[model samples]
Target: MNRKLWTLLIPVVILGLAALVYRQAPRFPQEGSAAVIFARDMRLHHAQAAELSLHLLERPVSKEVRLLAGDILVTQEAQIGQMGGWLDIWGLPFSGRQAPMAGMNRLSMGMATDAQVNSLDTLSPRQAEIQYLRLMIQHHRGGVLMAGQGLKSGVPQVEVLAQAIVNSQTAEISLMAGMLRQRGAAVAVGLPGGSMNGMPMKP
Candidate 1:
């Protein structure tokens, strides 16, 4: 009778321990998951925006441009921190080994090329302001596009940040457009459903 009882208890204990282990197992976002991709790509994207803003700040920009640059720098840096935190929590590396934005037009993502980024240093203060506005406007548009894609991530945090990005960057695009007009400059890159120098913006 005692042997029979011990056998039943052994199976029950093993099952309980198995359930506990499963419950405590870490559930991380898989490689190439939407949340992981968004977190990684957005960090890189925000870094460029912050860098541009910082560079603009070093020049003798107008009062309005200075304030705008300051705002962008602060906002983007904070978002970068948040995204980095997400990646850490997901048990992922800061950057994936895969090529960034593989198979996508880096421009469509609103990324500046090495040449464009290098050009920022060559401009006079006035030129810097205008160029900054144009580049940043295009950059914001790209951010909006990427954020729109991220909205489908189905991860609560990613979706929330993506929505916030869409709202803020869309408003900033309009604001920058107005600034461009004030400077008597036109946007070098087109907005959504539009063309920049005859090149249509990707949907």
Candidate 2:
């Protein structure tokens, strides 16, 4: 009887241990990191800007402004599609349950606030230009952060993509900064870590 009991208990113990091990395994791939998160979140963020670009394109402006906004819209929309493609290929969602910007605390540049985005929408053409420039410059900074991190992390596609983001964004940053000074509204560009159009970074 004792021998029979031990035989039954052996299978039960093995099954119990197997269940525990399975439970402890991670749900997502172990490769999950800033590279993946940024791609997903930034795609959504860029989509929002792309929507605005469509609206602004019709509003009218100088050749330079129209060209700039047009380029931004087209480029970012393609980028969004590209990143979304990556997510699709990787079998990942475009966004997780976490807040877009907040979850990116571990990433480089994160998403802009909804309110900051709204302020961009509210400005008149002249005001909008400055706001767009400043906001986009800052937005690119966030992208740079993610891309730089991806480079350091040695994620293949992410590193290559990040370098591109840095190159493009650096140029935009200079352009916007120059434009701000030229307009004598450099002070209007909010300081980093300030209100961010009244929606402060989430804790």
lDDT of each: 0.82, 0.65
- Stretches > 4 Å off in candidate 2: 1-31, 97-99, 104-115, 120-122, 187-191, 194-203
Please provide, for model 1 over 8-59, each residue's C-alpha lDDT reduced to its tens digit, 9 standing for 90 to 100.
Answer: 8999999999999999997677778888888888888899999898888888
Question: Clashes in each model (backbone N, CA, C under 3 Å)?
Answer: 0, 2
Model 2 steric clash total:
2
For all predicted structures, in order, the TM-scores are 0.86, 0.67
Evaluate residue 73 in candidate 2 and report its C-alpha lDDT on the 0 to 100 scale: 91
Stretches off by above 4 angstroms in model 1 are 1-3, 20-26, 188-203
Give candidate 1's error at residue 41 in angstroms. Answer: 0.7
User: Per-residue alpha-carbon lDDT of model 2 for 1-203, expressed as tens digits?
Assistant: 69999999999999999999999964432235776766776676677667656655665445666787789898988888887787777677776666555544422243456676676557687777776666666666665555555566456776777788778866876776777777787523333644333553221
